[model samples]
Target: MLTETYQQPLLDSIRVIDHPEAVRRFFGLLKELIDIVNLPNGDARLVFSPSRREKGVISADINFFQALRIQRPPHRRTGRGEVEYHLTVKKSCQERLASIEELVFEPITEKSDYVAVIIGQSNAHLLTHITLRSCWEDCLLELVESNKRGPHSARHNSDVYRAAEDEALLSDLIRLADDPTLAERGQNGTTVEEPEADYETESASAQQPHNLILFGPPGTGKTFALQPYLQDGNASLITFHPSYSYEEFVEGIRPEVLGNQITYRIRKGIFHKACMSAIQLAGYGTLADCLNDTPENRHRRLRKAPAHYLLIDEVNRANVASVFGDLITLLEADKRLGAENELWLTLPYSQERFGVPMNLFVVGTMNTTDRSIALLDIALRRRFSFREMVPDPGVLPIIDGIDLPQLLRTINERIEYLLDRDHQIGHAYLTNVTNQADLCDTFRDRIIPLLQEYFFNDWSKIQLVLGDNPSWGKDPEQRLIWVRKKYTASATTRLFGEIPESVDEIVTYEINPHLHRSEYDQLPVETFIRIYQKPTL
Candidate 1:
């Protein structure tokens, strides 16, 4: 015995060079190292440590490593007590717990920024040669215990949780990740089995842009219309606005207030955070995990899975020259992550130390009505694919899951009659209906008011659309009618003053540029004179 043999097995369990399995097995406990270490069919170094020794913890030392141990079931041995295998941890795991140390025999006492150590046995070693320093230890226990049957399988998280023993499950995943064969496939590690799969991966060498431009008049639902694309797991949304500062979006010194003691921490904004997360998850093969994976594990995404969207709502509102800055590079089909070209320049927000990874698509939306997109910078316009989303009546019917034929017809007619089919609103606003009550509230809150704004009148025309009232007209009488519909009958007198509702009505009118002599025949001479009196009358 190496004097520390009893304890050595425990420490060794966590010290796999890269193979989590070998370390687990060396420490004789039970027979679950294969599962906990997650070995499938490959070779990996299993680093080991018997226990923690806190002589002094160094910061930023290249030789540093973190430790995690897996214990086996107790049993009798042939000539000695009992012996089992101990799985070795990985360099990456240890690197995660920089500035922290693991101690054994005694629980870590003072909390002066100490790392979690699988106490039984463990030790740290420097690896400055490879520039791979700062090993961290994030236990996969919660992960594997929660997910035992593997992914894309129907194994309920509860099933894994209800089990009395789950340490083996995590151990299994870790071991499997070290497998060469599984890495060949997209299952164990971030690498793909076939080189051909890179086309679909987000971190792959080849990924093209999937940009889209949303354009239409205000309130036509361009913003809501792109929600699905914006949050589509694989997609990350980056807004372009005049006041949207680089400091706010990338990295900035945010004021940190500790009572009266205030200081600034290098706080990263949403875009930077999303980029870091994308870098972390760039290797995951599946879209779901790639989109919603945890912080550390998210880095598993292997393909670039062209970030689905980069919704730029009201893109025209932004000063195009300043907003995009150098981001235009990612928009190019030739550009990809890890490219050596200057086109894909790294931001100050992410030095190698900042930990932000590259690989995202930019989809900007511009409302032509806000400003002539024609005025947009020629440099930017050429780089992006300008796809317009003009108003279309065909896009407004959302009768999913319920019999709303009558309601649909009425609403459609109102939207079309007053707002015109080209200006009709998008139906995406109503996709959230869970039941009947929800349906009605949405109609009242969203549809009814929008229609009223178009007709520039009260309830009668709206009632005509809803089949609520009989008399429907394009005359002034209908304008007040629509307004009254918004309020109760008693409040009608209160709206638009005490005048008759008919007086407050808005008569429909349209300007005619070309008219023949007969068009004015019905008008009196005084009416003709009135029309012609624009000459400083």
Candidate 2:
């Protein structure tokens, strides 16, 4: 056993590893290992001790490796003085281990003592290697059986080793060990299964909150990306604007006319209604099944319920802090109903205790042009996983000798330079353009009006974005934004027989009317191509 004096130094040495996330995960994994392998007589201090020969390296004791024990040399120091953790694997496991780049097996001696070590550059590389190693479960079971047959077998007979028997615990430890985010979740005393690749068929075992926010510029397919999760009848969509309030999101009071007299009644809002639907789908008898039951009992009663989704569009338009209220904390995966840190709140309107169910997933969309993610409420940002939906020009096809992809890309690049990436145009605007007529109509209706708003009708900047230069003397019909310079000095003299000295030449801009006129059919393909092409010197 390490003395109290030595323990602090060992922790200090581990803390100097440079990556805070990796350090956190190391401590979490250490606690789990101690719980699993350190018997009543066994000391957990043996798991990590100061190295006698190496200055920076902490000698991770071999006893801690009972579940996945290898030969004596548990760790080796590189020339740079960094420690590399390794384990000895059986021949069968070695063949399966070859596919993993992080786990490499090499000969340590003249005999068959080959050890595998993680050489990846990631901070949690060592921890990830141990959990993801091949045949780990088999080795763990073998260790348990071996301990039963040992000389001091009575020490291993207690419930201390009972956790090793749980398949769910073993699977979760292996699956979640690599994620740094899981370390944060460990603080709340809960473990969640990894989310499935297909959300529609997501497993009921996953305890992580499925809160996702898709954000990007307008017309970037933020809403379209949510289609897959909405195929079933379990999904509902709602839009938020500046006037959106918590009263409409959660439970609130509403005025109802009863026999010519106004009466105020408690009404369930969209979020409250969604929670009720999710609880019912999870096989609960009533809302009381969640509010009154303990977390453990709720966990046992939870069935393989169908997932319920609430899609919030234009999420950033409303004041999220005021809208979510105290329920924001309940949105965390570990704070959901039946979770380890389960929380409940009494509604002010109905006075009913309510909790967010794990089966309910919240997905939101934000238009970054309207609101940048940096300005979002910190509480809301922490609760949701954000996925960016930037424009992809490659998805646009060529139309009638015009490179629609390049045209869109060029315009966005200029827009990004003039304003910011959040104001750039999305490729979806050109996805439907199949011919010159379709392209003309798109620019006349959607593209031109969008640019006008984006640049605040600054004709010169808009002209530059549309590939027009005032000095080039380009044909007026060829330009998307036709510029007409009006000498205010001369205009004022003609109107009132007096010229104001303050009035100088002013440039007026308008979208070419010919784009929508009958002459559009006669317009050449060069009109669109020139938007992306370089001008001749």
Candidate 3:
């Protein structure tokens, strides 16, 4: 959730403002600042650029040279109700100048240690923890002279920023610990059963790393969402797909050539990495952390390191046996490292425990559109709750241009017509198509090709949704191609006014080709790109 964005300060400023409807103007200005700088932290100084027009040219005015002083609460929620803080700006009209609260420290040259203007004001205002460059101490002399408020004022040098971070973390922990639906009525549900068990890092739920499932199809934003959970704790991500053998997912014998000698190395596959990560996180150090780099000896130092998650991308592609290997016992929710649960498989190398560690969550994603995925074992299917990651119709209305509200209704009607007869195109595919190109081009090339892949038996489905009567071909495959090509042409014409004369005329390109495309093979790629997109152990 840590965004590499310059809008942090502007957004933070917006959050400090409590009024509801009035915040709209503030939000617009904040977004304007974001677009102007484009830089992560808005490195541009508070320059007095009054001469520039506010059209396409972007710039900031000097607000800091003058100062404004006021007082506010330690923690105020944004309109969305998240805890935050803002600057206390008070400008006396008679004085003809604005003054700000005293800054915590000052700014300097180091990028890592300091970001002037925004960061300087942030430390002085919200956090007060002043992460500063080496020159901050010397540069702060200016603030001391101008600041109307005293250096040690309760508002200045406050620990409110650190306190806010801690508060947010605790709040999230509380939300995760109690299954909100299971809370007893009349009870202060926020009041935890064990106040000491604040961090789920040591909780029973965190051990069941297998309880989760990565729900998005390829490029459905699944990995992007999973990264926060991975970075939040000691976690590992294992991607599963057809041809991802047990040898690749679990432990396997890796052949080594030593001169004339043939050596067998017990190479740890993705599962080995996941387990080792889990064990190290459970309190046990990693094999590399404690022992030598030889993979054969890694099994020697295996212990609990309290893992938090084991994300399995496209899990349905691989056999459950290969994916889980010998770690079934650690994955069950009831079974934990210390606490006992229903007897099942014994861990091969760790302490006596059945089921994944209580803190370990197994999150996997599956694409139901893949007919071959029907090969998924019923037993594994029964264990996981499969929530479809289809694009919500609500999102379509939010998309700008082309009468999306009307387009959405048409999409639903077509989808309903398809689903009523056993055909169901995923919403994720639609969203992906919609996201391609600009507002004009999206309706033209991007969505049409994808819509062709909708897999509907009813020809009318295309006819109703596609606006004009689709020039569906006589054959099914031909019809699908016709749809793709027609839509591509329409979208292109809408975007660029007409199809390009040559490759150079094309305005834009896309990187994520639909996974449904079969032309991409013979190269060992998915394992690295979509699979290992997650950080390693």
What TM-score fits each model? 0.42, 0.60, 0.42
Clashing pairs in 2: none
The TM-score that candidate 3 achieves is 0.42
Which candidate's lDDT is highest? Answer: 2
Q: Tell me the TM-score of model 1.
A: 0.42
Give lDDT tens digits, candidate 3, residues 1-537. Answer: 111132123223323433322233222333333222221121122221111111111122222321111112243222233222221222111122113233322222333222232222223333233332212222222222233332321111111111122233223323333333323442333222323233233354434434655453333556566677665444566677678876666555665543336655444455555544454433333332333323222222222233456677777666676556655544555443333442235334333223333334567777554533346665566566555554444544333223444444455566566543113333444454342133324433545554556643343445445432333113222122223333366677897897777633322322223323432232123211211122232
Off by over 4 Å in 2: 1-209, 301-304, 471-474, 488-492, 516-518
Task: Estimate candidate 3's alpha-carbon lDDT, on a 0 to 1 scale.
Answer: 0.38
Ten consecutive residues with minimal summed lDDT in candidate 1?
54-63
Best by TM-score: 2
Ranking of all predicted structures according to lDDT, beginning with the best and ending with the worst: 2, 1, 3
Candidate 3 residue spans exceeding 4 A from truth: 1-209, 214-221, 286-307, 325-330, 342-355, 371-375, 396-401, 419-440, 443-446, 456-461, 470-537
- For model 1, residues 1-537, the per-residue Cα lDDT tens digits are 011222223223333233354333322222233233331111112222222332111011111222233333233321222222222233234454344442222122343122333322223222111222222212322222222222221111111111112243335334443553543454533222234344354342243344446565454566766666543244555666778766765565665443236645455555554554344334331223333444333333324333433456667776766655666555454443433321334466434222223355455666554566677788777777765564444443333334343344445556677655444555454546554445545555676566667566555465555443423323232121223233444455576455554444333321111111223233222221211122232
Question: How much is the lDDT of residue 39 in candidate 2?
Answer: 24
User: What's the distance in Å from true for residue 79, model 1?
Assistant: 28
Prediction-by-prediction clash tally? 103, 0, 48
Task: Give candidate 3's error at residue 135 in angstroms.
Answer: 45
